[model samples]
Target chain A: MNDSPVLRVRNLTRRFAAGVVLKSLDLTIERGEFVALLGRSGSGKTTLLRTLAGLDEVSEGDVQVSPESTVVYQEPRLFPWKRVWHNVALGVRTPDARRRAEAALGEVELAHRLNAWPLTLSGGEAQRVALARALIREPELLLLDEPFASLDALTRTRMQGLVGDLWARHRPAVLLVTHDIDEALLLADRVLVLSEGRLEADLRVDLPRPRDDGETRFVHLRRTLRTALGVTDKQAIAA
Target chain B: MLDAVLAQGSRIGLGGNARTTTGQVAPRPRRALHLHLGSMRRLVSPLLLLAVWQAASSTGLVSAQTLASPLQIMLTARDLLNDGTLTHNLAVSLVRAGVGLGLAIVIGVSLALVAGLSRIGEDLVDAPIQMLRTIPVLALVPMFILWFGIGEMPKILLVTLGATFPIYLNLYKGIRAIDPKLLEAARTLGLTHGETVRHVILPGALPDLLVGLRFSVGISWLMLVVAEQVNANAGIGHMMMDAEDFLRTDIILVGMLVYALFGLASDQGVRLLERRLLVWRPQAHRRG
Candidate 1:
């Protein structure tokens, strides 16, 4: 039971009326593993994340996600009508919700804004609230779909640290979908490159935590991933 | 796919409304200076018009038969109040409008919930309502009287029918316009369909629902007046018709004034409700 993977997908495929967006993709994430999926725009990056998040139909695949899996979307997606704590505790419809939500917001360091509405929150603060909402669900497979793609540089760095710290504390199998190369290297246990509806490279990032740009291995891994992402679709498919 | 596109379009539109109000067009000190004058400014034209009309009537430039002077109308209003005719008739109109508006709301909101929340429900409910809506509702009045006679039934039914569409259409549009990303988030959060309706769909649609209700209230009064004009036993409309027979234009003006005040007061009431319900919105309760 302990050795079982948290998420397993076999031959996943998603096709819209226009064309196939994901083509027989296979992925597995072990318990407590942190993996980052990186790709350029229109490279099936969001399509794959959405599929694993179960937002779309798995037209031709077998997917087995651990129960209580949840997604943090690119936008905060907080209900503008609801208060901060209500947004966090929305899924947990049980007694003592206030306490659990308070604790979760505390984890995200947003306890001070417990009653604040989503519209009043700054971008970084709202994203942290989103993180708190995701955490409150206690999801075994926490999917992050470009969650920090909109923040400023300074706020993005701080949010990265917060996400990293949360992942360390919770030990959930995290799949962060992003386009930022350094962001992928700075956080994930493994980094995967997806393009043309298929993952082209899955590199294991065994470097130590807080892996900075000065390390030789980090530079080499970043270069390889950049090449993998930069290559034309035909070359990627051929390789 | 179309729904997703429309949802994003609505998100962009809502972004325009969500702009910060503090540093927008008007400066604070300038706005503060006009604070009292701003409201007085609104009353300026109406009061000036009233003064001109009173001057004309007092000088007998406009005959009393053609139009009652404002002073004479006020004196008539006092007589009606003292005799209790105005109070009784006003109560009658109030009950009719209130009951009709309330019933219309229950019916409208239920139908909107059914049609908005389910595809099958939309298929079942939307077509008939749409077909019924295009026909001018006032045209149904003759048929309503033929069917139910010149009784309270037809009056209430007419008001209900007239007011129902705005509520249904606005609320239906609101539900359809909900951002798909929010729905997707709800689903991933493990919300059941019922839970989603309760927590997200209803609240998301509330702003539009209130807008519909305001329209309905206005329409309800208009319908009530029409219904009463036909054969009202006792209502403000009945008082006006009676005054028409006697050529007592002052009483007619009194009835008109009551209806006008009712319209203004009720609209303010709905606005108050809006402010209370939409407390999350920054500009919901803002006053000029």
Candidate 2:
């Protein structure tokens, strides 16, 4: 593994027509680190992710990331005209691109759907294919833009577990932007809450692997995150 | 979603069983009625019109010289066929239509791509095409005859002019209507512009292009009918005019029927081409 950080953002400022969405933000994600960003709906989380993905330009500051980075959006965004394996192998240039794509689909447990159209896949299956597509690039940095927010509870849990497993295996530096407190707590090595376009809280999760809901540390961290997001103990308890 | 798929599966299963049960339980009279309904759906109007025509002919409601009877028309058709005049004229008209439509496809597709893919090309090519398309090609027959003389050239050119617009317009719309999101995805995936055109834009535009082809083929035949009327010596229109001069209304009816059959045949040909080319479309696989 490289000694340098996988991504470095310095004094990043993003301005929109309305006003400044992000004001001189700074963040660094080291190699193999899992960082989760929590924010309100309009708190510039997507803007930051898009910036890192090279989908948006920053008004000021510098962003340095590995060239082999890939982003997965909330919607699968797979080409509806392409089949499953073809979507995964979109940019692969090897002679065995088909085999590599099929293998990636197998990692997502969709090998049977190699030839299936993107339109026919269920929502969960589509998201899994999106994951396969991102991972097939073997990216050194993976940027996720609320990828699980659209899934149902059951599928979301399964997808969270899948992400955890894949992260353990591939060890890519991941930056996940989401609004769900539990999701951030469960998967991230460190969680940062964005409020008013700046970091509000930087909390670390020291909980053990396969952490359960019954763990006191996990609960404590959840409470801290909720408070940072302006949710009181009463609302937390109700939730 | 899985529930919906399962429900659909069960419905199809039950439908199959229900069809079998109905087939066994239905009596002979009901079966006959069903058969009769199927035939009546297609044949009723034509049979009724034929009966009316027969009554008019037998009762001398109209003279044969004015409006040929159905029997007279049929006999005339048999006579033309035996004399080989109908076959020769039909062959000539078909060749003219084929050559004209072929040229139209080439020119229309070339112009549509040049305009649809680039801003400067569109600015240069689209205005003139838009203006030309609005001037009905039939009205240009006299001009065409004067320009190209009273040979096969003017007739073929008329069909070409008539057929080109539908293809160009539909194909242009199709190229523009491709989803931008898909194009963005292709760009992010690092496909070159040429590759994108081959693998994405063309396939996406194929359905509309096929529709345009159907329209152009229809227009080609319509133009042929008119173009062949311009002092033609050997085509279907010429034969019809000759029959009219001699008061052979039966032969004129025969010519009209031949034109209708040819139009129907060309339309069917296009439909078959559409089905073969557009098999990727999901709706194309669905039965009525």
Candidate 3:
């Protein structure tokens, strides 16, 4: 299986002025693995993602993350002034960076939008550009902070498929922070539920690619995760 | 190859759609013409008021001594133009304004960068500036005269005082108001501090800095009027003061008109610059 941990954390503790958000957490993400961390709001999924992305200082932790790591935030977080190609080339210093950015955008089917402004793009398109920007860096570990949360359902589904295809092609270790159980199940090889500042459940999906909702195992896994996250039928229906 | 074919197909489709739409875009010209007339419509009221003033003076209801008719003011302007007084004084006033406003932009932008980018600079520079802004610059004119004497120095200094605060305050606010998310993203991209400031902070603050510049330009002219009035050898204020001594209200009115014309011209100049520089802003908001 060629198992090697790309990210390792032991007793990872994060504290803000309010109090500790992540408490004595332990996690290991393997190279080329797709892991989804599911949590209800305020379960500190974002804090963990930030820590992994080197955005936040953890209070106490022994963390070993790959140097080549990038984060895609909830918002596109694109520089509004820069064109799409320019933004994709933002981290690259080479003279051929623009050509590389255009090629990356081609992979995301956004080659036509190279000269377009970020403000002019739709939510899904902007997120795709953000994905392109991250992928251009060729990060060993790609952290996503609910990158599709703001997208419409149809667009979100399309983006999920695109991400799946990209992951298969590029094979980067991905840790996606999402609250949607179906999204986690759809994209991840492993799903871990976070609660009380700890990972309460870690389950592996033995399902094949292009997972179907009609599958009995998929529904069963969904129900199990829904229960694990304390999402009652009423709550789930309302959501 | 199929992707390229699809892209080319979409481009052709878009071009065809644009061409078809262009034929149906007939109302735009009429609407634009209406907008043009709407702006020209503003001139009617002022023109009517000028007509009434000229009529009242001609009818002897308003005496020439009390108010010069628009025609008399025009004649006075012509005489000043012929004698070279108008151009010479205008050039002098413009020079003073240019020098003062230039110094203000340099000093105010420097201070704003310091205060905006660092806490220590803010604590050291912002308090004194806020204090100075409260005391009107005109009130400081007498103190300036007593300290520096009634020369070109005091006039230029007064203009500098008037122009500095708006540029500093607006630019400082602009710098502080930049999106922290953008900064975070830039840092994640491995941009150094200098690169971040150049690529993000300064460009983000530019819109507000331009607004400050518009105000500063207006203030420079106003302070020049006041400062030149104090004790001037040349400029519009000196011209007006001399006309006051001779009781040539026509020439005085001419000087005031020249000031108004210059104010309008400079303001329009700033608006043009704003349009050129801020084309990234939405179209409707970019209009002068």
Candidate 4:
């Protein structure tokens, strides 16, 4: 992998009509790095993700990212009218597009759903198709916007495993914006907590791959992130 | 949230239906015998109503002059069929409706595309159309007759005018109602403007267009009825008008039956088209 940063945002700021959502925020994501952003609701996590995905405008400062990047949203956003394979192959230009689609779907374990309509797929299956679509682009940067947040506990855990596996294989620079502390530690190389407009915490994990929630360091980091987000131990226990 | 809901919903729907192929509307697999029996049960009331009408007419409880018996109407229909008056007039009426509806689809869809896609286009096309659509277009037949001289032109024009609004209104609304998230997805996927319109905008808007088409076709027939009543023409309405001069209620009733049959048949045709075109919508497969 290249040593250069895949994304660089220097004193980036974004404002809406109501007020400033992000003010003088600076961050950099190196190529092949995995970063998980944890933030409370309405803490401009969405605004930052949108800015990274090129879906929103920057009102101030420099924001530079690799042109070859894609996002997998919390929702699948698959076209209900399109078949699974076709949804994955959309805008893909290749002489062997069908073969590529089949291969991509195979990665997501949706090979059996090649001709199945998107609406026919269950929620987990649909999100898998969304993953296949993003991966087909062979992006340098992958932005996952809480892709498993809505899934039931079993499905969410399975999806998290799948995402980690895919990341291992592709080694794309991934920025996962999520609320789950356990999820962040399990997947990311670095954990950043965005409270208000600024990133308040940038903790690097030195743990090995497939880190367990039961591990001592994992528990310590989880408690630290919770504190950074202003959650007391008693309050966290009550919840 | 939509993903979570759809996942849960589909998981529930997938129980015992994993073997079924995609997007066909039975939430559960239906047995063939049950389907046939269900259809038969639903048909009972309509057949019973027909039987009651036929019985009242056969016993001479209702006079032929006041109201033709179903038997008399059937006999008159056979006579008209044998002599080819019914065939020729029916053929003429079909041509008018078909041609008028064809034109309406073309004009309405083009206008809707123009108005629905852009702000400038909406500004240019929507105002005049909104004003024109408010005026019950069947009321324009007299003016159309004067301008176009009560020939095929005026009749076809009336049908075209009457049929256009529903398609325009429904399709325009469909365009506006497309999920914005899908468009955002399309943009990220790198679809060009034309490609986005073709794949995303068109398919997304089609359900409404079909809804409009059903109304437009029904409106076309209504307009044709009025159009044929006005002048020297070869149509089902003209045949009915001639029967009135000779006080042939049986032939007039036959004409009315022909109109009703065609109306029902055309509506069924649109419904079939809906089933085929919108196979993606699970609701389209439901009996209701």
Candidate 5:
């Protein structure tokens, strides 16, 4: 899997009139690898994801990825006027669009809501539908930007499990941007932390499969990650 | 607790049978027949007002000739219908309104697309359109008459002028109000500019555009009535003007009623089209 990088970023930088959001950064993601980007607000995590998705132009650097890449945004961003089935099948309409949409919805456990309007969906359901829409394209790469941020605690955990299950099934290389450390720890094989537009830490999670949050190793890893992020136990208590 | 409260409430209506709570009593759905009957009952007020008007004229409280009774207006309407005058005038008014409205929609939507999408286009056209929108449709009557003469052209142009601005303004607002994230998503999905406009912008703008079209249709009907009355012509408005000259109050009243009915009918047509086109939108309350 590590023989060649599926996506390579070299000196990727993005700047706005406000200031430089992502200063010269380089990262290479191997095929079928799940990578979680951890960052604080305005840490250029979303900017980098958008640039990779080709939704935003980079100020400097090269992002070389396959053209068959799809992004799931923070918001579901489904067309309000389209039904759940239609929204999932957006842009890739063929004779099999309905069949593919139904399969995707089934994968997200929203098969019963195929004909329901987008406006009627709950936040979690909508985001699941958004994920289904992105996954239906069968892309070589998938970029997710805080896709489960709006979900409640239980729903967010369930979605993290769902993402893990999907990654196991599809084996598509995923680059996910998230602020939640536990979510990054649970989902990513490796997590990269960004601070002030620079990669602060790159750590590999060597935990065993079917990892439990209550396990001693997971707890120790979380503490280590917190320390590396410069958040002391006192600061964690204060928060 | 909620179940206990519901049980107690149900017991009050059913002679204190606790076992009744265990059995699900399906709700008796209200019939559409009863709903229709209720609506008919609500129409009594309008009927009473008409009856009062009829009685006042019959009792000579007001001169019958000055203010025609409902019966007299109905009789005049029957006479006009028999002679085909009413249908002829109605057809004329409808044709003018239809042509004018079609033209307005095409021009309004095209211009709105240009103005809404391109910054340079908006800057160049927005001020001029705003200026034109401020000018009353009636104020353009003389100018249209001079340009196209007192034929059907002037009347159609008047309706067009009245209908254009609302559609343009609403369409532009709808386009601008689309969520930027949705457009970005489309770009990421590899949608070209034309495809994005077709798939994203058009559907996003449709609801507002349909609402604007409803308003525009009403405006067209109003302006058409006034425009048809401008010259010696054959229309409901012209008929009313002629009847007023001859002191035929019943015919004048009938003409006014026809104008009101036509306006309502055109508006309803627009609403029906909106319903068919925007099947995804929830049903909203509207007056008949």
Candidate 6:
């Protein structure tokens, strides 16, 4: 893979009528890199993600990226009027749209649900379908905003593995906004912490593919990330 | 086969069933026929009410001239049907309703879409439409006749005026009620303004639009009846007025029944269209 930067955000700031939500935030993502954004609620993690995805306007600074970038949201956001296959295909009407949709569903292990309606799917299944929809576009930059936050623990873990596998295959530059430190360590090459709308810490992980959750390196990275965000052991235990 | 299918699974099949081929479901047809017959039980109340009315009229509980017997009304309806009077009057009323409803949909939806999309659009049209809507439709019949003449133009104009407001109000409410998060999601996908309207806003407003359309259709029929009563030579409403003058209670009763039947039939048609269009919507307990 090329080592050039695929997405660059320089001195980005956003303000609402109430107050500033983000101030002087700068983040750069290299091609084929998986970066995790970790922060507490209201720390502007979502705001930063939205800014990067071009969903929200920035008050100052420039964001430069390739034309092919897509975001997957926390909720599936699949059209309720569409079937699974149509939802995945969305507005794409190429000759191979159906085949690509089928393959994307297969990647998410949702091939059997091709003709199923959006309402009929379980929460986990719905989120997987959403992921499949993003993947079908073959975006150069993939932004995920806590896509599995609403899933059960078992399903969340399974989805993380599925996402990791898909990323391995697609090799897109990924920026994942998440609250879970362990999830960040498990999937990202670099972990960046946002505290009070500013970049607080950035840690790089030089780990191999399919890293075990129970490994010492994984535990060390997770603890470091939690400590950087000022999350105590007591809080972790409570959670 | 019913027992087998139920035994095989209790949940409604989302994905297609693989176990059953075309030849494997023989008794299913019989069970479906039985299910339909069971649903027919719900119609018993209306039939019983008609029977009671027929008995009361036959027993002379009311004067036959004042409260027509069911047999007399039925015979009158049959005569009207055979002579083509009923069909012609029904056709005229239907045409007026159809033309008026079509115009209402176009104007109401366009105005609602504008009001929903922009603050300026909302400010420009909202107040006047609101004021216009509050004026009772029956009150407008005389004004319409005077302005447009007592012809098809006035009748159709009256129907359109009556139907437009409900659709506009409901559609505007629907547009405003869309979840902000969905729009945010669409924005993240890099959707243009027009694409957002086509893919997100329109679909989001559909359930409300359909509800408005249903109400508008009902209003159109009401307007038709009122409109036809004003210096008209044909239409069910006109027929009813003529019957009243001649003291032909049977013919008047038949006219009233025809209105009721047409309303029910038109409502059923809307329901069918709703089912076909929004098959993916979760089946709610109450239909709009």
Off by over 4 Å in 6: A1-3, A17-19, B1-52, B284-288
Listed in order, each prediction's TM-score against the native is 0.92, 0.84, 0.90, 0.91, 0.88, 0.87
Q: Model 5 residue A79 lDDT? A: 86
lDDT of 4 by residue, B107-209 (tens): 9899999999999999999899988865667567678978999789999888888778778877887887789999988888777788789889999988778
The digit string of per-residue lDDT tens for model 1 on B1-288 reads 423433343333233221232223334687777876888898999999999999999998999998999999999999999999999999999998988888889899999989998999999999999888757677777999999999888888888987788788878878988889899999999989888988999999888887777778877887887889998889999999999999999999999899999989998998788778887775552432
The residue-by-residue lDDT of candidate 5 on B1-288, one tens digit each, is 423432332223223121222233322346557767889999999999999999998899867568999998899999999999999988888889899999989988888988998899899877799887655557677888899999888898888877787788878877887889899988877677887888899999877677677677777877877788889488778888888888889988998898788878877787677657765644321111
Count clashes in each candidate, considering only residues at least 3 apart in sequence or on different chains.
Answer: 0, 0, 0, 1, 0, 0
- The docking quality of candidate 3, as DockQ, is 0.35
Q: Per-prediction DockQ scores? A: 0.72, 0.26, 0.35, 0.56, 0.50, 0.51
TM-score of 6: 0.87
Q: What is the TM-score of chain A alone in each candidate?
A: 0.94, 0.97, 0.96, 0.97, 0.95, 0.96
How far residue A119's Cα lies from its native spot in candidate 5, in Å, is: 1.6
**Residue A221 local lDDT, model 5:** 82
Output the better candidate (1/6) by lDDT. 1
Second chain alone, TM-score for each candidate: 0.88, 0.85, 0.87, 0.83, 0.83, 0.82
Ranking by TM-score, best first?
1, 4, 3, 5, 6, 2
- lDDT by residue (tens digit), candidate 2, A75-119: 888866567898898778888999999998999899999998777
Candidate 6 lDDT at B68 equals: 91
Model 1 / residue A13 / CA error / Å: 2.7
Q: Per-residue alpha-carbon lDDT of model 3 for A125-232, expressed as tens digits?
A: 999999999999888888988999999999999999999999999999999999989899999999999997899999999899899977999999999999999988
lDDT of 3 at A137: 87
Question: Which scores greater on lDDT, model 4 or model 5?
Answer: 4
**Residue-wise lDDT of candidate 1 within A1-239, one digit each (tens)?**
47899899999888888898888989999999999999989989888877778787776889988876899888999999999999999969779888999999999999899999888899999999999999988888899999999999999999999999999999889999998888999999999998988989999999998879779999888888979988544665595
User: So what's the TM-score on candidate 4?
Assistant: 0.91
